[model samples]
Target: MKLRIKEVIKEQGLTVQEVATRIGKSKQSLHGIIEKGNPTIGTLSDIAKAINVPIYRLYEDDNDLSDSPVIICPNCQTQIPIETSIKIKSYNHD
Candidate 1:
């Protein structure tokens, strides 16, 4: 999975150094993790906390899946097909 660490950091108006400081990592180490393309769950969790975003926000939305509607799971960041999403409209009589 492609993690959008850099993009999310940019979106949040934060610099890599700021986030590195928040997560207790050196700027060079953080850059290495970003360039490595695969970080452990613990690392991702730490980054999420530092950036103040759900871990799912760090995932790059799959462009190939854009043709189909999908919903992201907040916990695991797995994409759920829209058809499989439970409908609540029927429960809303109002």
Candidate 2:
């Protein structure tokens, strides 16, 4: 699967160095992983945790996401309409 790590990082206004520090990796190492466009499961998990986003979010393509704000039911997989707003929380990778 194509990982959107770089895009998500940019969208979150986070630098690779920030994420690298959070994940206990060097910036160069993180850049290598991003440049390769593939990371091991453990590395991906660390990145997700570092960024405070659900793992699945990294896999979602912006083009594939609908413009409408809707929540997907976990069990039945139904799309439920909901009022929502894009709120970017301050990154506290402490």
TM-score of each: 0.69, 0.62
Stretches off by above 4 angstroms in model 1 are: 63-94
Candidate 2: where are CA atoms >4 Å away?
60-94
lDDT of each: 0.82, 0.75
lDDT of 2 at 51: 89
How large is the C-alpha RMSD of every model relative to the true structure? 5.3, 12.1
Query: What lDDT score goes with residue 33 in model 1?
Result: 94
Lowest lDDT 10-mer window, candidate 2? 70-79
**Model 2, 62: alpha-carbon shift in Å?**
8.0
Clashing pairs in 1: none
Global fold similarity of model 1 (TM-score): 0.69
Writing each residue's lDDT as its tens digit, candidate 1 over 1-94 gives 6878999999999999999999999999999999896777788889989989876677787665545666665467578776655656556566
Best by lDDT: 1
Error of 2 at 76 (Å): 24
Tens-digit lDDT track for model 2 on 20-68? 9999999999999988876776787799888887555565554454455
